[model samples]
Target chain A: MPSSPSNQSYHHGSLRAALLSHAMELLDTKGIEGVSIRAVARLAGVAHSAPANHFPNKRSLMSALAARIFNQLENEVLAQMETTSGQRAERVMAFAEAVVAFALTYPHRYRLLWRRESLIDHDAELHSAMEAVYALLIGTIEGEDDEFTTSLETRAIAIWSMVHGYLIMRLDGNLMEKTDELTQAPRHRAIITALLEGIGGGPSGARRDC
Target chain B: MPSSPSNQSYHHGSLRAALLSHAMELLDTKGIEGVSIRAVARLAGVAHSAPANHFPNKRSLMSALAARIFNQLENEVLAQMETTSGQRAERVMAFAEAVVAFALTYPHRYRLLWRRESLIDHDAELHSAMEAVYALLIGTIEGEDDEFTTSLETRAIAIWSMVHGYLIMRLDGNLMEKTDELTQAPRHRAIITALLEGIGGGPSGARRDC
Candidate 1:
């Protein structure tokens, strides 16, 4: 119960940092089911009960870990947005690329973030981080000057779902990575344009300046 | 190793069929991990070696079960497509509705279909069923007459990814079910339309008749 002071390697905020670092390693190597408070503590070379102050149970530990991962994702998207030329379509492309890069780089972490069942009460910090990313993405679409039949939320959801599904498919080996030959663009760029320009002139294909 | 002749409850093709039925029960109630050769054998009240004639291991058992489930999903989609009005967009809507219904009704079964890692060599029957369903969806898009910057395959992938993403999010309870207030269409319908018409006229928003 009072092992914090006795531990020389872990003291103050350092212990929490050590625990989280070890927790991420476990998550990356063994997936979410392999992670536990005791396992993380053991990995960190601390007493099993030492993590109690930071994470009381496995669920809380997972919740905190997920929140931390989402924060990284949020920062990635924000950094991409900040560096973009700020055009609506350009920002959309940048946003999609940032998310795809994140998912590809840390596939397991990306998977853990969406698996709400494995975390605790849908942790508030995690929720906010996710919402912030969504808000950032939607902000780009909201800047469009023309009127459309669908709401901004619909447009946002459509893009998000498409990217999310496409990302998961590639990560799971259900789909392959490809590129557009004529335009010399990644398949994702083609896909995003396909949605932006409509397909085969079905209801919204006219490029008129209306 | 199986005493099939002596067991009064099992005779002829019934043992194989019985094993499959119990395997599905395990899949529905306990997910993919719950169903295995040993577990199905035990559940069917047969010797552990009883399933050896039909399935050599957990992978083969899951492969057969996945094939059967894909057959069911294929039939559901075919029936929906057949009943559609033969219009391109109408058939597209019908195809999307059928898949959404199937995923909703058998969420666990739907989940297993895409999870190739749990099955054996991506069983031939299962592969054919999936290809057939995909061809059916792509057929609708191939009927479009106007010139499109994106190839037919790109267009197909875009809609497919959007619908797939939407379905998974709803199933996982990550996204709430909502309807389009202006057109009184389900959010899925709106999403489909959003992709169809493009958004805010970034490149394809004009509804002009060309």
Candidate 2:
């Protein structure tokens, strides 16, 4: 009889990557709690023991997944910044658009990253990766010093808050009808303007007729 | 012989409240997935069947728990607002401080409220309670508005984003370290000032030297 694949010791060359891809799909369907080695292996069409060899336990799997997601986001932002040349406000907007697009495209993954309160602890790599993302944001804000304060950390927090909140609201369908009253580009610009100028500092950015 | 009273039906007169309370503690300790009606009943020192008489399912239990937390937050904010009277800027400062204080005091519960994306769709009562809290914030801003270009909903979103972002960063210990630079009163004032005036409109309320 021909050799059976199930009996083969080394079934696939990239079981780890396959497991993670299946895990992401499970997250989209069942959310964070739904992920497990057996579940992932089942989805990946592998024996149940296959994932145990890779992840061993749930915490290891979660940390690895979160690290991968943040790393991807970091690379995307860095690439966007490297190629873009514009005014400080323009770069800020481009960065914001890039972030929003990421969140929109992988809504479940973005939600999983923020859901790390339960999963993250003293892991230095995860901690530093999160901080690295924050630093990139602060770097983007460096260009806005002429228009705003140079406290990159504080301004970054303000911008992060606005963008994160907007993304969450949009994903939840809360921003649908109301945001239609104004074009998103101008609203985003006005918010970036507010972050740079303060609330009452700039020429009233609101349309007079609206 | 008489039946053992503890094991008998109706062992706890307030089994419903006890179950919810126990579930909240479990949520804090183990996050959402760790919470189960049977586990809550076990923690509450009641028969496992007792929780079913009240909640019937995990979804309903979670919904009830979220409602309780929201009600507590609503009461806290209203009580704090009642004690403060001032201009628009002062009122905004007071509100922000109350929000920060509340979130800091109950970090786990706060995360449960904010980080759980599925709650918005699963529970109508919970959703309405949340909207009511946002309305209170809108009323505070409306009291100070002279122009009213943006709708109350938009303004509420802006304010919530700022406070929510601040709380998230503060909890993660990602803020600048300059404790003595501004007293609580001034820090509160500065955030409100920046919100009202925009970045360059006036002093950011930060230490002028920085």
Candidate 3:
């Protein structure tokens, strides 16, 4: 997987990215406990101390990796928004679907993004990236309705929690075993729609009368 | 902590409980990685092999612990339901509050209860216990309303996802940092209320009109 650094020598700027990439691979296969600076350096085909130049400790490396995941998550959500054209509730469902898709695609990395210990020290960058995603959700919920009096931030948190929680439960197989169906996408969409409806809205624009 | 099995002899049933108690303490302080069958035996002052007799392996021990947590969660939710007298939405909010409180009180144990690997082997029992909790929530939502066409199961899942997701985010300090207020109870209540509202209901019993 190491591309020989392209120039046959690891550039200083690329070393950090290489270490992070290798560490993520280790995490996918061996989990968080399997990753270490030395292992990442070895996987990158660099000197043992090479990773130290970029990440002072294991925690820092994990933090950087988490930050990268958050950035990716933000980008993915924005990308989904760009391609989906619908009413506010439909658009929100699209965001939820994108999040579930991302988590299902990379379950380990998605879990790592929410690891409390790893993200504690990287709050500033991680929070900023996460906030961008939340902004999209909040804006969609707010939409063109200037009379909406409920706190948009609170709505965003609830929506994010519902969708994120569903993804986690799905990954853990909690949702699948309860139903006879082999697939949970339809159920998940229904749950999301119900939650949206509970918030005083719906896919059919029923809340406009309220 | 072992109490010498209380009869100066290691009874099989008591030994299992003692080991699980010690293991939970270890889980709370040192996390899941800190727990092991041997370590639990050592901490409980039992013979090293004592735990092996009851648990058979580390996964078995962890599975037992997870089952206990689910049972405890069910009890807590049931207790909340008992004392809470209100319309459907308020009662559901009470259940949500109880969950968040339990998770906040024992964050590590709460996380352990949902670990996919740990509970995979114990799915039948664990799912049964969790199903009881969901039944309570579904019953509350379905209360005296035969005309409610939405799936109670889907509503239950959405409510669970929102509340569980909020607790995880709160434990990670994601919710606290975004707000100036030190307390999250009110914010949590608000979020739950909004989600319920989105489902075409509210704390004021307005969904009856639907």
lDDT measured at residue A90 in model 2 versus the true structure, 0 to 100 = 63
Residues B13-83, model 2: lDDT tens digits:
66677678888899878866687778988898876777788876667788788878878788888888888
Q: C-alpha displacement of A35 in model 1, angstroms?
A: 4.3
Candidates, ranked, DockQ: 3, 1, 2
What proportion of the true contacts does each candidate reproduce? 0.49, 0.24, 0.49
Error of 3 at A180 (Å): 7.2
Model 2: residues with Cα > 4 Å off, grouped in runs: A1-11, A79-84, A143-150, A173-194, A200-203, A206-210, B1-13, B28-34, B115-122, B146-151, B172-197, B200-206
User: Compared with the true structure, what per-residue lDDT tens digits does model 1 show for residues B89-189?
Assistant: 67778878888889888887887776555677546776676667778778867855746667677777787788888877776655343323334437787
Pick the TM-score winner.
3
By lDDT, who's the top model here? 1
Please state the error at residue A144 of candidate 1 in Å.
Answer: 3.7
Model 2 per-residue lDDT tens digits across residues A1-210:
124433335576677777788888888788776877789889778888877888767766777787778787888778887777776666777777677778878887777666655355545666677778777877775643333332344456667766776666566654333564565534544444545444433235454322
True contacts kept of 2: 0.24
Which whole-number lDDT from 0 to 100 does residue A174 have in model 2?
48
Q: What is the C-alpha DockQ of each candidate?
A: 0.40, 0.31, 0.40
What CAPRI-style quality would you assign to candidate 2?
acceptable
